[model samples]
Target: MERAKPSSIKRATALRYMGASGWQPDDATTALLDRAEEKILAAATPRAAVRRLPRAVFPPPELDCGTDLTRHLQGCDAVLLMAATLGSQVDSLLRRLELTDIAMAAAADALSSVLLEQICDELEAEWRAKFAAEHLYLTGRYAPGYGDCPLELNDELCLAVDTVRGCGLAITPQHLLAPRKSTTAILGIADHPVTGTLAGCTTCHLRETCSFRKQGTTCFAK
Candidate 1:
């Protein structure tokens, strides 16, 4: 298991998660977000685990992750299965806030989402450099539930990475990641650089009903 240091969340990213992109927050809202960020940072403990496996071992035998993921991994020699979490303390903080201050709780939730992504981003950077040293390249990180990929694949991914024992990451019966701010993903290890990968709302499974799209924005909106 690899531990990551807590980092500051991008305010814009958190605002996007909060559905407040392009809308200037008033002083009160800004202060609320500031406090939320502080609390979330104090409560989060980022950790991750990665398992590199042969391409043949991916998708497991009984499951199909659809063509999008298949195409993403085409020609790759190996797969990097990864799991990460913001830890249970953040979940506990949110639960406590939900009892008294709904707005604060919501803000903290959004910030926590952004914080988790930041942790993943840092990990990706590390992986990139580490692989580059071996003269290899990586495809973008593709998580289950991203496009045609079945969300249930998360179960297999968690198992592959030993997420529960490694980082206390688990999937609930509802198939959602426990701790609320954890993720599982895979990346292709290609001898050559991978290109033309589709990302953002275009490939997202929730595109049809995405609140960001309905609001004339995107989750990736800056």
Candidate 2:
């Protein structure tokens, strides 16, 4: 029943979600963001769970999660499969907005996107602290759809974490994650923290043309 209680989501983060390259928010955008924040606060039900998976299960059958993952998980004691969600109500709210108001719908979608990342941020912080207590450290979170990690691996992640039962999240046959704002990712655990810079946006498939990248911003920046 643990949950992520995000406090004061930054306007800049939401603006970025709306594809805003600059800091200024026009009146209309500001108003939409104001309204969207209310929806996010009401709808968010952040929840997360992490489970240990033996390294032997690294490459699930038919999964082509790229070589980046192979390097990330190298010299690990075990792999951790993580799943987190802002819950189904958030999706329901976004869907309802699509029919009622297109602008609001888009704004709501953006807000939810930022909120989900905030939730993941909280989850990672908690995990980091927990592992530190045991003299262990975690590699940066590497999710399916990152680098060589195929989106299809979502199925394996969901199954490994029992995501549906644990948090009402799932992956579709098309590889999209459900509870639309939810996420599944992996982390490598070791006695020592990762020594060098971990590959993040530099290894992303969309690095070349990502809008945020063009603005010198990366979603993966810590």
Candidate 3:
């Protein structure tokens, strides 16, 4: 897949990622966020790869994604595996800021998280338009480690999309994306409209302990 221009990341979304809620930033805080956004945007070189496969052939049997994801894909005939990253330069930038300014690093980290999600959202929008022409509908994108999906599937997802060769995306031994701002997800393509497929607190493993939930909000809240 080709890179598309990213939509601007909203301050509220970035603040949510930083575990802040029901709070308004002062002028100093806003300036810190601005600097973080600037550095992250300068360092970001977003790229992605996608692979479409028949539902029957997905998950590869050996990897068990559990019942929640199975339910999420119930009516779909095909699946799209996608991987995306903001490049290693962004990772390097965060590391340097951590040494010089912890607060700036934290802000940058949250902003990077928001930026990566924005890229994925744009990719989904593009695919939605493309599939619309084919009369196909897509379930919301679901990433590994959500609900009962195993994080180990990240390795398989990276391979399926050839992310390493296609976008220089990599998985660390801990089953985490190496760039620290990368993501891998799957979307189900169905003949009819699909609902309740979006990732939310109800299906999230961290739901109980999630700070966002405690604050009367969710990570996915607009």
How many clashing residue pairs are found in candidate 2? Answer: 3
Give Cα distance to truth, residue 106, candidate 3, Å: 1.2
lDDT of 1 by residue, 111-187 (tens): 99888888898898899899999999888788888878888999889988889999999998867899888988899
| Steric clashes per prediction | 0, 3, 0
Error of 3 at 3 (Å): 2.1
Task: Estimate every model's Cα lDDT from 0 to 1.
Answer: 0.86, 0.79, 0.85
lDDT rank order: 1, 3, 2
Native-referenced Cα lDDT, model 3 = 0.85
Give the Cα error of residue 208 in candidate 3, in Å.
5.5
Kindly report which residue stretches of model 1 are placed more than 4 angstroms away from their true locations once superposed: 199-204
lDDT of 2: 0.79
lDDT of 3 by residue, 4-88 (tens): 5454567888887887754799999999998889888888999999999998888777777877888889899899899989999
Q: What is the TM-score of each candidate against the true structure?
A: 0.92, 0.87, 0.92
* Pairwise lDDT winner, candidates 1 and 2: 1
Off by over 4 Å in 2: 26-28, 59-62, 195-209, 213-222
Clashing pairs in 1: none
Best by lDDT: 1
